[model samples]
Target: MFNYTMKDNCLAKKVILVTGAGSGIGRQAALTYAKLGATVILLGKTVQKLEQVYDEIIANGGAEPAIVPLDLKGATQQNYIDMSSTIAQQFGHLDGALLNASMLGELTPYTHIHQQIWDDTIKVNVTAQHLLSQALIPTMLKADNASLVFTSSGVGSKGRAYWGAYSVSKFATEGLMQVIADEYDESNLRVNAINPGATATAMRATAYPAEDQSTLATPEDIMPLYVYLMSDDSQNTTGQVIKAQ
Candidate 1:
């Protein structure tokens, strides 16, 4: 088990937003943030899953959360802009945003990569994130302090065979994090990337079906990095890729 000392007061009065909050790392992070005293905004395509997470947070006596049903794959810039505006109107300001929604297009030979799959993956995993961040930065700037975390992967830093569009998208995410971090270097906002190593999740299972599941850590196990990145404890840290295991 992980040792978590972040109390209900750690993120008191903070307003945080998490994409992909329907499941896996994003869901755990959302719950953890709520437990730490942050009012979380859960954004995902599936409203039912987000509702379950929201109910869990409230039932546990943590903060109540807001849910926004959005599919990153089909979301437009206007949609992201509207979301940012709505969040600003409701929360006054946003203190954190976790760009965790991503797609694994396919693991196939480079020559066999379908153009449609490649395009869709890049849009969901890269372009959508970029647009969302672009729209939200203004809202976040209104806060006293802000944090942005991008979900990255091992293949992002080191190219591996058959990783295809997923790898390319992650690499783009890392670069996006770096650029944003640099732009906000003098501001109260900090941006960083976290590589959740070989976690036991649906995404992991799909990517490596033959791997021994017992050997891998659960999504719950690597939350320390997620919490640290979101907390004031790591306020000065930015533009770095971190491994969570």
Candidate 2:
């Protein structure tokens, strides 16, 4: 149960993009953003899941959301360019993006990690994010206010055994957030990273099978921070990592 009071229309008329919006935290964030008055752009690899989220948002009387089914593992610079162009044409400008899509490659020792797994993890969690941000920054700059939120994990700060490429990828995510935040310090656009600690997500279950699911915080429980960072409330906040539990 998140106790933060979200003002109605806090995000009124804003255009926000959320990656990995098919399920988990991304899904919850997208729905919440819409409820607060943003026209959300749902981006994920699974069309079916995206559609399900789409229906939920519409059924709740939230803003009409657009869907973009994109596999980050295979997404190229051109793919991102096209997405940016479409967003600019359709929405005029993007006010925010929740860069929540990530791949948790197998949890194995560094020596046991497969080359393919490492490459794919980096491609999805790092390369695609970089390209997408590069393409979307221009769109964000067009807006009067903008925010870019990157997802991070505990392993990102201190490498853990058997975390492998996932941990390394999150480290890269942190670095990307800091660099972009610093560059945008003088601009209206703000960048920050969030570590959704011990959430009950499919990815978390896969990473910690022995843990009790009921003990973990649900995705909805983390929406307060997500909403705050994306909304104008955090306009002066940037280049920092916050924990959501």
Candidate 3:
């Protein structure tokens, strides 16, 4: 696991956005950020799930979280722009954004991948992220310090045979992170990527159903790195792909 001792209320007064915030790593990150004194915006497709996370945050005495029920597969650039505008208006600025929403298209051979699955994966994992980042960058720049963290995978840097579109999308994700980091290298905004290696999530279970999930790390286990990247402690770090394992 990535080692970093987080101080209580490390993210005080910060406004953070978390996609896929309804479950898995996103949910844990949202809860953790709220607990650390940041107001979290939970963006996910399922309304009920988002409500559950929102209730949990409030019940745990964390900040009151806002929910945005959105399906990335069908979202447009305008939708992201409007979301950014809303955030700017509501919070004045965004301190951090964790682009954790992604789709695992069928893990089939390269040649056997379905067209629709490939399209959906790329749209959700790559295009939507690109658009969202573009819209969020300006809002993030308004803060004293901002972190933009993109989720990568073990197969992002090195492609695997059966990973197919999911792997390709992650590669694009890393590239996007680098591009943004370089563009804002001298600014208050920092950009980076995190590859959560083999965590025990629904996606992981779907990818490796037969594996003993008990042996894999839980979403909470990999959060030190997640919190580090979002916190001001990593203000000088950018354009890097860090592994949380």
Per candidate, the number of residue pairs that clash is 0, 0, 0
The TM-score of candidate 1 is 0.97
Off by over 4 Å in 1: 1-4
Off by over 4 Å in 2: 1-3
What's model 3's TM-score?
Answer: 0.99
lDDT of 3 by residue, 12-60 (tens): 9999999999999999999999999999999999999999999999999
Over 1-245, each residue of candidate 1 has an lDDT whose tens digit, in order, gives 14645555688899999999999889998998898899999999999999999999999898789999999988899999999999999989999999998999899999999999999999999999999999999999999889999999999999999999999999999999999999999999999999998988888889999999889998778887888888888899999999886
lDDT of each: 0.92, 0.94, 0.95
Ranking by lDDT: 3, 2, 1
State the RMSD for candidate 3: 0.7
Across 124-240, the per-residue lDDT of candidate 2 in tens digits comes to 989998999999999999999999999999999889999999999999999999999998899999999999999999999999899999998999888999999988888999998
Q: Output the number of the TM-score-best candidate.
A: 3
